[model samples]
Target: MEFDYVIVGGGSAGATLAARLSEDPGLSVCLIEAGGRGDGILVRIPAGAVAMLPGYGKINNWAFHTVPQPGLNGRRGYQPRGRALGGSSAINAMLYVRGQRQDYDGWADLGCEGWDWDSVLPWFRRAEGHEDGADAFHGGDGPLQVSHQKAPRPITRAFIAAGQELQLREREDFNTGDNEGIGLFQVTQFHDPARNGERCSAAAAYLHPVMGQRANLTVLTGARAQRILLEGRRATGVEIRRGRRVQQIRARREVILACGAFGSPQLLQLSGIGRPEDITPHGIEMRHELSGVGRNLQDHLDFILAWKTRDTDNFGIGLRGTGQLLRHLARWRRDGRSMAATPFAEGAAFFRSTPQVDRPDLQLHLVIAMVDDHARRLHLGHGYSCHVCVLRPHSRGQVSLASGDPLADPLIDPAYLSDRRDLDLLIAGARQARRLMLGAPLAPYRDRELHGMHDDMTDAEWERHIRARADTIYHPVGTCRMGVDEGAVVDPQLRVHGLQGLRVVDASVMPTLISGNTNAPTIMIAERAAAMILAAARGEDECAGHQAARAS
Candidate 1:
C-alpha cells in the first residue's frame, strides 16, 4: 500500500495531521495505529477514566512503567499512556491548557524560529472550537471542542474557594497565554446536543468524523509499525505487523512520526536512525546518526496530598456513592449533564513557588476524589485530593531501547527530583497546597489528613515525605526535540535534522516541557505542522511547474 503521507500512531498529533493533510482530495493519507479504534463508550464518557487509569489491565492504555528511580527512593513510577486512537488525550483529565507564553518564547530563544508565542498562538486557535465563541484567544469553528464543565461537583468549587481564600486570584480562563492564577479548567469536551458531556478526544474530534466520508483518508487500526523503511537515510515508508501478517506500507511524499515522546524515540532507534551507542548494542546497523533521539526527557514529578473528607459530595467506592454515580450516568445519558461529565480533576491552579519568580513555576490539581498513586490505590469513603507538581524541573532523563525487539517497551528513566532545585520547588509548592486545603473555605468538608502531615513539618521532613510518594503527572516531552542547535533531533520546521522525507509532529518535538497540561499543545503542534508540510509540498509543485514551462 502507498500513500502521499503515511502517519504512524493514530494519537493526538497523528490523527489531527492525517485529517488536515487529507483535506485536499488530491492527496492520500494513511494513519497507522497500534491499538484498536478508540471510539468505545469508556473513551467517550469523562468518568470512565477511573476504570482505565489504574493500569490493572491494558484496556486502552499503554500502561508503561519507568525504571526504578533513585530520586523516589528507587520506586518504579507508573507511566500510563493511551494505546488507542486518541493516545493519552483519550485517557487524560481533558484539561485544556496552552501553557505560559514564555514556554513558546523560550523555544524561540533556543533558536526555534516559528515556535514563539506570537507564531504558535494562531495554530492553537485554529485547532480549538471553544464553547465561549470566537475570541482573540480562542477559535469557534475548529474541530477540537473546548467546553466548560457541564456539572462540577460542590467539592471542586470548594477547592477553588479555598484557593481564593488563600489570596490566590480567581481566573476564569487559564489559556490567556499567561496562566498565573487559580480556577476551574476548561476541558476538551463536546457541548453539542448529540455528543453533549462526552470527552472530545483528538481522534473523536479529528479522525473519526472524517473516517468513511473521505476516500483519500485511510485509518488502519491494530497495525504496529515495526520500523521505518529507509532507503539510504531517507524514510520511504514503514514496515508494520498486523496479526500474523508483516506488510510494508510505502509513502510517496513523506513518513511522519507521531508516536509521542517515548514511542517516537524507540521506533527511531529500532530503525537504526539513532546514535551508534543506542543502535549497535542490539546488533542493529546504523542508518542515521542522531544523538539526541532519546535524550532530554522531562516530566512533571507530582506529589499528592489526600484527606478523608466527611463530604459525600465527592466520589468514592462506597455503596451509596456507587448508587449515586449510577444515577448520574443515567442522567448523563438523558440530558448530557451530571457527575458523569466530571473530568475528576475539576480545579486547577498555577502559582510561583517563590515571590521573585518571573512566572508560575508550580501547578496544582484538585481532584474531587481521593487519588493515591495515580488512582491505583482505593479508599472506602468519599474524600478529596490535591496534587502539586514542579512546572519546569531542572532534572533530565532519557528513553533507550530495552532490547532490539520492536514489541518491547522502551526503558524509561524520568529521573524525577534528580536535581536539588526541583525538590526545593516541589517542597515549596506542597507547602502552599497544604495551606490551600486547610483554608477556611474547605473547612466544612475537610476531615483528617491521610498522610498525617501537620502545619509544623520542617522542610527536611517535607523533602523526606515527597521522596517517598512523588511520581509523574503524565506530562513527558523533549525526547525528539526540535531546535536549530546541533543537539536537536528535528529542525524548526519539524523535519529531521539530517534526514529526508521524514518529520516528527508530536510532544516529542517540544524543545522543553510546557508549563501546564500537554494535550492542547500537542494538538496545536500538529495543527502548525500540517500547514508547514502542505506549504512545502505546494512549493515543490510550483517549482516543478516553472521548470516544465521553461523546458516547453
Candidate 2:
C-alpha cells in the first residue's frame, strides 16, 4: 500500500494528524495502529476507566513495567499506556489539563521558536470544543469536546472546599494560563445530547467521525509497525506485521511517527535510526545516528494518602457502594449524567511547595475513592484519596531496547526521586495535601488514615512513607527531545534532525515535561503539527510550479 502520508500509531497525535491532513481531499493518509479501533464499551463510558486502567487484561492498555529503581527502594513501577486508537487519552481519567503557560514559553526559550505560550495557545484553542463556548482562551467549535463534569460527587465538592478552608483559593477555570488554586477539573468528555457523558478520546473526536466519510483516509487496526523502511538517510515507508503476514506500506510524501514517548523511541531504535550504542548492541545495523532518541525521560511521580471512611458518597466495592453505582449507571443510560460519568480523580489543585517559588510547583488530584497501587489493590468500603506530585522533577531517565525483537517491551527507567531535590519538593507537597485533607470542610468524612499517617509525623517519617508508596500518575514525556540543540532528536519544526521525509509528532518530542496532565497538550501539538506539515507541502508544490513555468 502507498499513500502521501503514512502515520504510525493511530493514537492521539496520529489520529488528529490523519484527519487534518486528509481534509484537503487531494492527499491520501494512512494510519497504522497496533491495537483495536478503540470503540469498545469500556473506552466509550467515562467510568469504564476503572476497569481498564489497572491493565489487568491488557484490554486497551500496553501495561508496560519499568526496571526496578533504586530511588524507590528497588521497586518496579507500572506504566499503563493505551494500546488502541486514542492512545492513553482513551484509558485516562479524562482530565483536560494544559500545563502552566511557562511550559510552552520554556520550549521557546529552549530554541523551539514557534512553541511559546502565546504562539501555541491558538493551536490549543483550535483543538478544543469547550462547553463554555468561544473565548480568548477556549474555542467554541473544534473536534475535541471539553466539558464540565455532568454530576460530580458531593465528596468531590468537599475536597475543593477543604482546599479553600486551608486558604487555597478556588479556581473555576484551570486552563487560563495560571492554574495556581483548587477546583474541580473540566474533563475531555461529550456533553452533547446524543453522546452525553461519554469519553471524548482523540479517536472519538478526530478519527472515528471521519472514518468512512473520507475515501482518501485509511485506518489500519491491529497492524504493528516492525521498523521504518529507510533508504540511506530518508524514510520512505513502514514495515508492519499484521496477524500472520508482514506488509510494507510505502509513503510518497512522508512517514510520521506518533507512537508516543516510549513507542516512538523504541521504533526509531529498532529501525537503526538511534545511537550506535542502542542499535548495534541489539545486532541491528546502524541506519542513522541520533543520540537523543530515548533520553531525557520525565514523568510525574505521585504519592497517595488515603483514609477509610464510613461515608458512602464515594465509589467503593462494598455492597452499599455497588448498589449506588448500579443506580448511577441506569441514570447515565437515561440522561448521560450521574456518578457513572465520574472521572474518579475529580478535584484538582495547583500550588507552590515553598512561599518563595514563582509558580505552582506541585499539583494535587483528590480522588473520590480509595486508590491503591493504581487501583490494582482494592480496599473494602467507601473512602477517599489525595495524590500529590511535584509538577517538575529534576531527575531524568531513559528508554532503551531489551532485545532486537520488535515485539519485546522496551526497558523503561524513570529514575524517580533520583535527585534529592525532587523528594524535598514532594515532601512539602505531601504536607500541604495532608493539611487540606484534615481541614474543617472534610472533617465530616475524615476517618482512620490508611497508611498510618499522623498529623505530627516528622519530615523523616514523611520521607519514609513517600518512598514506600509513591508511583506514577501517568504523565510521561521528553524521550525524543525537540529543540535546536545538538542533542535534540527533532528540529523546531518537528522534523528529524538529520533525516528527510520523517517527523515525530508526539509527547516524545517535548523538550521537557509539562506541569499537568499531558493528554490535552499532546492533541494541541498534533493540531499545530498538522498545519506545519500542510504548509510545507504547499511550499514544495509552489516551488515545483514555478520551476515548470520557467521551463515552459
Steric overlap count per candidate: 0, 0
Query: What is the model-wide C-alpha lDDT for candidate 1?
Result: 0.91
> Could you give candidate 2's per-residue lDDT for residues 1-552 as a string of tens digits?
999999999889999999999997999999999999999989998889999999999989999999998888899999999999999999999999998999899999999987888777778888889998988899878899999999888888888888888778999999988999999999999978999999999999999999999999999999999999998888999999999999999999999999999999999999998889888989998989998999999999999999988888779887898899999899988988988999999999999877898789999999998999999999998899999999989999999999999999999999999999999989999998998888888888988889889878898999899888899999889999999888999997899989999999999999989989999999988987888888788875323422332222
Query: At residue 144, what lDDT does model 1 achieve?
Result: 96
Candidate 2 all-Cα RMSD = 4.0
Please, what is the TM-score per model?
Answer: 0.97, 0.97
lDDT of 1 by residue, 1-552 (tens): 999999999999999999999998999999999998899999999999998888877889999999999999999999999999999988999999999999999999999986889777778888888998888889888999999999888877888888888778999999989999899999999988899999999999998999999999999999999999999868999999999899999999999999999999999999998889988999888999998999999999999999888778768788989998999999999988998999999999999877899999999999999899888888889888999999999999999999989999999999898899999989989999999989887888887888778888999999889999999999999999999888899998899988899999999999899999999999999988887888788875323422332222
Residue 401's lDDT in candidate 1: 94
Give each model's whole-structure lDDT. Answer: 0.91, 0.91
